[model samples]
Every structure is written in structure tokens, then in C-alpha cells.
Target: MGFTTPTPIQEQAIPIILSKSDLIGCAQTGTGKTAAFLLPLLHLLTEANAGTEEENPKIKALVLVPTRELAGQIDQAMEGFSYFTPVSNLAIYGGGDGAGFEREKMALTRGSDVVVATPGKMLQHLRMGYVDFSQLQFLILDEADRMLDMGFVEDIRQIISHCPKERQTLFFSATMPPKIRELAKEILVEPEEINIAISKPSEKITQAAFSVPTGLKVELIKYLLSVKSVPNCIIFCSTKKSTKDLERELNSLDIKATAMHSDLEQVDREKALLQFKSGEYTVLVATDIMARGIDIKGVALVINFEVPRDAEDYVHRIGRTARADSRGVAFTLVAPDEQRDLFKIESLIEMEIQKVAIPPEIGDSPPFDEGNRRRGGGGRGGSRGRGHNGRGGGNRGGGGGRGGRSGSGRGRKPAGNRR
Candidate 1:
């Protein structure tokens, strides 16, 4: 009865989600989003499960999240909230070693009440006749934007097609993007919507970007970690190779850091996460692929060792900090060539990121623009072909909707904002 007081997003979304109506919730991350959906799903299941036969209750709930980390995180939350009730659950993700999952199969196959799974791995079991979704009554798609961005549309469709169309549906994402909106129309009927988008970074986090030369990013990271106040931090790289290289450099510098990426074995990745969580490591450098579902607490800083390519990713990267009412900082190291991309990020999020002057000791230099001269270099240009100098021109090619609209060119703002 005493789940922490509702955040604004939760206050608005939970009731609607519990009312047996389809819902689209647009809210920034770290706002008790998991609870907003989990609470209602639990309320529904706890009643259905009470005094019911345990051996064959039939799977009543399914949560499909965008990443493996999120699937595990949500499954844990479900167990925590439903502790005293008859509800049971399982977390299924890809890349885990066979033995770890094999231990959990008994609980999973015993007709547990809820299943949290990643789309690809769940499909493997569904096709093999291991999981039957015929009686599934609730479907929650968490981090819907990232799912669409990562090309999960077909898998999502297949999963939905397998479920009962009359059941309640809940879709949550930090950003709506057009593709998510269209998908919502297809899956949800007469949906209630809630949007709590904080276009700016969280106040607890002091955000600033440094202009650095691409080659010197690792050096800059080394220097940042040298600072006395550097607490638990995550260094974000756009690719796996960079993550490994950076890990090597940090270890060489006597910094306790590890890389968490898809390349690692599932057990190794889980070990890395647990080590970072238990204070055995100070830094966890990772690629954006694992951004959405990691829920580590007390993360004092998030450093974008490599700036993200999309504004949504920038938000996801920064989300690791300022969680659960704790203040944190997110710093981005931007190279000169990436200035334009940073500008695009600003435009997409509708907020200005403060610029941090590089300390002379780092020797990071701004890159020369096409004009063959050094420039102040701020702000991503607009979609309408306007340069930083305010020169107006035609719209950029292949530009149509907010947050990369595709298909028919019609994109709806995330669920609740339309009101």
C-alpha cells in the first residue's frame, strides 16, 4: 500500500493504465516509470491470482521491454511489489549462459503468472512451444521509442498478434517519435495518454559538453577520473571497439573500470554490472545498446566519452544519473567534427546544452570547418538548411517529421501531449 509517492508521470498514468483502457505514456526516464506500469499490472494480477490454483494459472501478464537489462530490471521490480501475493514471474533475456537460465526454467514453466522477456529470445521459446500466450491478458511495451529505433517493429508485431486483442495494453517511452505513434494506433484502441517530457536535462544533473579532439577523448577521460570528486561514473562510447580500448587505457591508468557491451558473454556482462554495483569498480564504460534498462543507483556522473548520434540517446545516456531523487552530473566530450551532430541533438530535445571550455592542459582543439578556418562552433543546424551564420536555404533532404518520422510522414506527439 505504500509504494513511494507518485511522480507526476505516475500520478497521471497509473490510474488510466489500471482502468482496463489502452494507454500511451510519454515521460522522461527515472521518474518511477517502472512502478507506474508495474503497480497496475500487479493490482490486476494479485486479485486474479488470489486463492487460485498455482500449478496452471496461465500466463496473465507479459512485459516486452527494448533491452535485456530492462527486462531483468522490470522483472525484479515485479517480484518486489508482488512479494506477499500469489503472483510469480520470470525474466528472460538473450546472451545469458544456458546453465543460469536452465535453473529458472522450472519456475518459468510451472505456469507462473507473469513473464518479462526481450522480443527476440521470447520468440525463440514461443516458436518452440515452450511459452503459450493464448491466455495472456495484459501487455506492456516499455521503452517503446528505443524498440522502434532499434528496428523491433516486426518482432513486436508478431508478439502482439499472438496476444488477445481485447486485453489491456500499456506503452511507455521517453520520446514518442512518429513510428511509435502509428504503432500505438494499431495496437491500442481508444487509448488514454499521458506525456511528461522534460526537454531539458534533470536539474539534479549539472550538464555541460567539452569541445575535444577525437583522438584525445581517452586522455580527457583519464584527466576527468583524476579529479578528487569523481564518483561512480559510466563512460559512453558509440561502438564496442572504443569501449574495450577505453577500458584498457583506464585500467592502465590504475582506474577500476570495466566495459559492458554486447560483445561480452552474458555471465561476464552480468558480472561487470554486479561489480560496478557493489563498488568493486568505479566506472562502467558501455555502448548505447545497453542504455535503456540499466538501473544502478548513486551514479555520481555519466560521461559521454563519445557523444551519441541521436538526441534520444543523449537523453538515455544522461538518464543513468539523477535517479531516485539523487543529484548527479552528465558530461559530454564532443569533438569538432561532431559539433553539427550536437546541434541536431539540441534541436531534437528543444534545449540548449551549455558549452565547457577545454582546459589548456588537455590540448583539445576545435576542428576547422569547411571554410578552412576555426569557428566558434555551437548548435546543430535546423532541418531547413540554416547554417550557424543564419544563412537560410531549402530544407535538408530526407527531413520530414519530429524525431525521424518514417513511413507515411504522419507522426503523433507521444500519447498524452496531444491533449
Candidate 2:
């Protein structure tokens, strides 16, 4: 909370939110988008609850997010910001036991001042008819684009049907795609739009890539870690299997690493995140689940073990590093078949990433020709393709469509980057 200066998004958004106007905020990850909405909303809520004599205060603000991790993170932020105030908040999300569910029910029925929840869990409570949104004043959707990409449109619509129609609605997303725009139109009314460097990686990040064969990705990653001596790093994989496999390989090299994915229980995921943040784990191998809304400070590096199918995801993956204006490094290992994906990423970020040569001991690397690879096929290019199929591409089948968010080869750049 040592925020002396406002980020561009915060400066533009806080005013509009305080004015009680619906707003569409488009800002890249690592910006202060969360604070932009929360600070003003906390002010308004504290004012409204100053002298109320009611036993059960009505829920004033509800924040809907894509994942439970995000819900918990926002809830923590809300608690920190409103510590000296009388405003109370609760985070309701899935993967809890009966006691946790009961606690959430009590808070919802008796009205917490602010509530942050994932769409599915909130919808489950709403269906039970014990939850009430009669006096809900502010409705905020953080990571709106991610919610849509996760196929939460119907759940969102159902949840909105319960809230009052005359509330100030805020839609915040890192990328404002056409579908996000369509959803905004349906919910937001004449909202003031604010965009701040959408889809651009932080200038503090030194971005580079190594064109390596699919078989030697682990070797390349180990080599980089040893040479760079990165104290804190997050390695992003496109699938859970890849995440676990990479974690194992890194551990085999005596590197301390942990894996985070949807398959882990909620407690384990939280523990992994906590350990990573607390320096217990020097490296966190994860799927795209860690790409957005999970903010950790002092991360020295971020590595893309494989290129994300969605180009915008590349921005969020590398965004884990270089946060809070600190300089960091981002390295991506691109195989021959994944060259096209890397090209799309470069096109979206509007700058070609430097291609670093792999060390001679790691053997021959793939040619950095996305065009030629596209003309031929997406095959692994030679006999070195042995381990490629096991890890699978970006859109492999997995729990709850985690891999399916890879948009069907449509090169849609993130919105609001005209400059």
C-alpha cells in the first residue's frame, strides 16, 4: 500500500468510479487495475456504512472473477485497504469443505459489505435462494475477458439477473476483445472507457527466446537457470502434464521447484502459491492458471517452457516478472512447430523478441523460420520430435477446459494498442 503515485489506469479509472459512472477499464497485467477500482469503491462503501443502525447491512459491492485464486487475492487486497474502516468483506469461491461453505452462506445471508466470488460458486449459492442482492450498489467484473474465455457467459448472465439493474457496473479486463466488447454492451450502459498499454509487456522486462528442439526444452531451461542464477522465477507451461513433467525434470537437476495447476486441490494450490511468494520455492512451474491475476513481487525472471497458443497469454505469463517497476528477464523456448505461435506473439507485442542461440552442448536448435514452418506442416520437423507428442500442444484436453481457451488460430490482437 506504499502507493505514492497513481498509474495511468488508476488516475483515469478512480475518478470515473468515484463519480458513480459505469466504466470499462482496459489495462495490461502488472498495472494497478485492482487498486483503481478498489480504492474508490472502498471510499464509497465506508461513507455509506458510517451511521447505519441496521443489524444486517446490505451487500453493497460484489466482485466477480474468473478463478478462485483471483477472488482470494482481491479479498486480501480489500481487507488490507479497508483495515481502519468499518467495511467488511468476504471471498466466496469453490473447493471448500462443508464448514467453509456454511461460513460463506452466513456471510451472504447476513450481508457482508463487499463480496468477491467466482462465477460458478456464486451461481451455486444464488440458485439456493438464500443469497440476496436486493441492495447491491456496485457490481464489478475483474478480468472480464478471462471470464468469457472460460465460458462463464451464462453464469455471469444468471448472476447479473439477481442484482439490481440500476447499480454502477465496472468491467475491467487486460484485453478487450470483440466478445468482451459484446458482453460490455449487454451489461454496461454508456460506460467511460479507459485503456492503458493493453497487451504490452512491461518495459522493465528484457524479453528473449531460444529456438530449441522439443526434446531438449528441459536441458535448455536448466542451462539458462544455471547461467542466469535467477533467484526467483516462474516457468509457464501450456498444459498440466507439461507442468508436472518440467517440475520433475528441474528437480532432478537439484533445482527447487513447485507445480501449480487446476488438478491440485485448492489448499495445495494456495500452499504452492504461498511458498513461491515466501521464497520457499525458487521456481513455480504452472499452466496458464498463473498467467493472470496472481501478483507476486520480487520475481527476477519468467520462462515460457512452451509458447502459449493465445498470444495475449504470453503477455500475462511474462508479466509475472518486472512487476512494481522492478527490472526482470523473460525467456521463451520455442520449438519448430511452435514458431507460428511465437510469431503471433511478436506481432501482438509489436516488437520482435531477440533470438538467443542455444549452447552447443544442448545440440542443434530449430531454425527460427515461422513462415517456412507454416508452409510445410506443424510437425516437429525431424526425428527429434519424439517427446513432442507426450507434452502435447497448447490445446490438449484437460480438466474444465483449461487447455481449450486457445482461440482457433485466429490472430486477434489485444484491444487498445493503436499507438
Candidate 3:
């Protein structure tokens, strides 16, 4: 992996990191951010181990992520890249059996050259008292923006408090929101900044929007999926209830579909994702938590069940497609009340989303300026308020509990740290 030509992030960030400087990498999803830091970290570890005899490993590098899926993804990539080198690694995250916890205990206590972990699960190990980072030399926050969004600020602070005072830090994020900048200022020391095509959706993704009534979204989705050869598609909803309702609706319509959200057990969620990747299921309905770090190569379509809270999120959702060096389509169903949301996205992207006419079978669309006349259906299946069903416990669920309590709150520690 290191032998391949370096991407823009790798080309720039690797050298600065090799020089032992802190760095802030701003890049979109799927732009080789993993290798940008992993290649250099592995090289450093290999150099440090050149003449030394291999002993029980002591943690030297710590990578903190926002989700278990991301932790696993990074850990798998590290194992692939470090195959030739003697460096060892482990991924510690929540959503597993007790045996999984025991295995993590063994890995953390025995030590690994590199440890990739989610904040909450990592905190559990820390509280137990054997997980030590005394020898830690590198501390990296991958997807720092998402970590912040998932309300890991206090957890991150507590984790940092356990690490060595003097260590190299690297912060990688898709966008430099003000909160991210604030976190960077607090954590980094004279860091070099690198930005590679942030906010803009991938060129390979054909973006389009359908102006349909909130009630007709299901019909529009059915029509689009039938017409387009969407071998593997993800329908992104704003809440877990919506994911469940949509999934149920699609399956009832005989569309091999599954729903993913925080409400499902970790194993089920992982299974659904795996099945979706293997083409066992034609569609997956999920919330924004899957927006980043879950990679399904050559995904043919990404349908936004509704406009996301912001343009950055839309970019992440569309990024799922147009990945693995292939072309894909991103279709958004915009209700009449979502015009301003669409406008925000258009302004951010500097282009219109090529609004498409609603299908005749779906009936009359809502007014173009229907802002609050009947702005219903905020939650899933006619339920309101951030997942009324017993599923508001995902690491990414519940905001202050109304709008975005789980994401983008000021530096407060989020609830549901049990995992």
C-alpha cells in the first residue's frame, strides 16, 4: 500500500508528520486519509524496531475514532499495510460480546504497537486500570469532525488526560467547522494544515433532486429504484424510526431491504452492513451514522430520503457512491418544506442539484415554497422527535433531545456512554 503513488493528502501530510510535526488534514471521504497517517506511523514504528528484539508490545500510537465501524475499518487497513513490518495493532470499540471485551482486555494490557479505538469503549478500558499509554508517542484523531459531532468531546479529553503529555497529534476531518478548529487549537501544537477538496461532492457522483410531497416520497423512491439499475443503494433517513419504517415499507414492497440504526444490536447492524455489501440485500436504509467510514465499493445509487441537516452531510452521503473509482448517482427527495435546505446545499456546492420532475404516478407535488404549512414527518413513520421508538440510544442519536442534540453541541459529553 505504501508503494503506491501518494495521494494529495499523503503527498503533503506524510512528510510533515515524518518531520515529527502535528498536522490537521482537511479532506472529503475516501481520499486516502487512512494511508496518509498510517503509512508514516508504520514507517516510524518499523524504524524504531529495526535492531530491537520483539518483546510484548507496548502501545506507541493511539487512534481515536467516533464509531466502532470506523475503528474496525482502520484496524483492518493497518493490518494490511503493516503486514511486512513487525508492528502489531488492535481495534477497541463497543457493540460486541463479552468475549470481545475480554479479547480487548488482553490486547490492551499485553500491549500493541498501535491501538485504534472508539472513545467510549476506550474509556471503559481506561477505567478498568490496566490499559496504559505511558509509552504512547503518537495520538491521532481520525474523523475528528465526526468525533465532535457524536459528542465525544469529554470522552476525548479524558482519554487525552491518560496519554503522555508530550506526543505528536494528528487531526483529520472532512470540514473545518468552527468547533473542529477550536478542538485543533486546544490539542495541536503548531500544526501544519492540509486541505484536499473539502465539502464538494465527488465528480463521479451524478447529483439530482426530486421535488415531491412528503407523502409521495415512498412512491418516488420506488419509481427511481425500479427505473435505475441500482444494484446496491443506501436510503439515508434522519432518524432510526424513519430507517425502520422505510426498511419495513421497502421490504413489504418486495424490495430486499434492511434498516440500520443505533437501535439494532451491534451484531445485527454489522450483519446488515455485511449482507448489503455482499449483495444479499439490494437496499439499506440508515441514518447519518453510516455517512462516513462504511465503504461499499461501486455502490450504484444513494437516495436521500430527505435533505440532510447540512451540505457537508449530503456530501458524505453521496460519497458512499462514486467510490472505488466508479461512477454512481445521488438522488435527493426534497419536500416542499425543504426548499431552503436544498438552497443551502446548492449555495454550498456552487451549483444546482438538477431538480427532476416528480413521476406522474406519485400525484401532485407540494408547493415550491411550502415552508411550515404542513411540515410534518420530522421523525420516522409519523412519529416525531428524534426516534420516539426505543432507538434513540445510538452513539449518534439524540441531540440536546430535539434538533441535533447528539451532534454538534458545544463541547459537552454526550449521553449513552455505556458502550
lDDT of each: 0.72, 0.79, 0.76
| CA displacement after TM-score superposition, residue 118 of candidate 3 (Å) | 0.6
Off by over 4 Å in 1: 1-3, 98-107, 367-419
Best candidate, lDDT: 2
Q: List model 3 lDDT by residue over 1-419, tens digit each.
A: 43558767778878977877777777777888888899998887676556554445677889999987888889888888876666778889878689989988976776677889999999999999998776777889998888988899999988987876667888888766678777777777667777674457777889888889888899888999999966889999998888899999999999999888988878888899899988999999999989997777878999999898666688789899987569999999988777777766765665667878786777876655534323532211211111111111112111111111011111111111111
lDDT of 1 by residue, 1-419 (tens): 45567887678777776666667777667878888888887786665444544445567778988878888788778777876665667777877667756644544455556788888877766666667666677888888888887788889888777776557777787766668777877777666777675555676778888888988888887877777366688889999999999899899989999889988887788889999999899999999965676788899989998778776678778888888778888888988767766766677555667887677888956842433112322333233211112111212222111110011111111111112
User: lDDT by residue for model 2 over 1-419, one digit each (tens)?
Assistant: 79999987788888887877777777766788899999998887766555554446567778999998999999889878877666777889978588878877876787677789999999999999998776677889999989999999999988988887767888888766678777787777667777664556777999999999999999888889899987889999999999999999899999999999999988899999999988888999999999998899898989999998888899899998888968999999988888888877776766779998799999887778857435533322222111112111121111111011111111111111111
Better of 1 and 3 by lDDT: 3
Instruction: Pick the TM-score winner.
Output: 2
Model with the higher TM-score, candidate 2 or 3: 2
- What is residue 72's positional error in candidate 1, in angstroms? 0.8
After superposition, candidate 3 runs with Cα above 4 Å error: 1-4, 370-419
TM-score ranking, best first: 2, 3, 1
In model 3, pairs of residues that clash are 398-406, 399-405, 399-406, 400-405
TM-score of 3: 0.86
How close is every model to the real structure, measured as TM-score?
Answer: 0.85, 0.88, 0.86
Where model 2 places Cα greater than 4 Å from the true spot, the runs are 373-419
Residue-pair clashes per prediction, in order, are 1, 0, 4
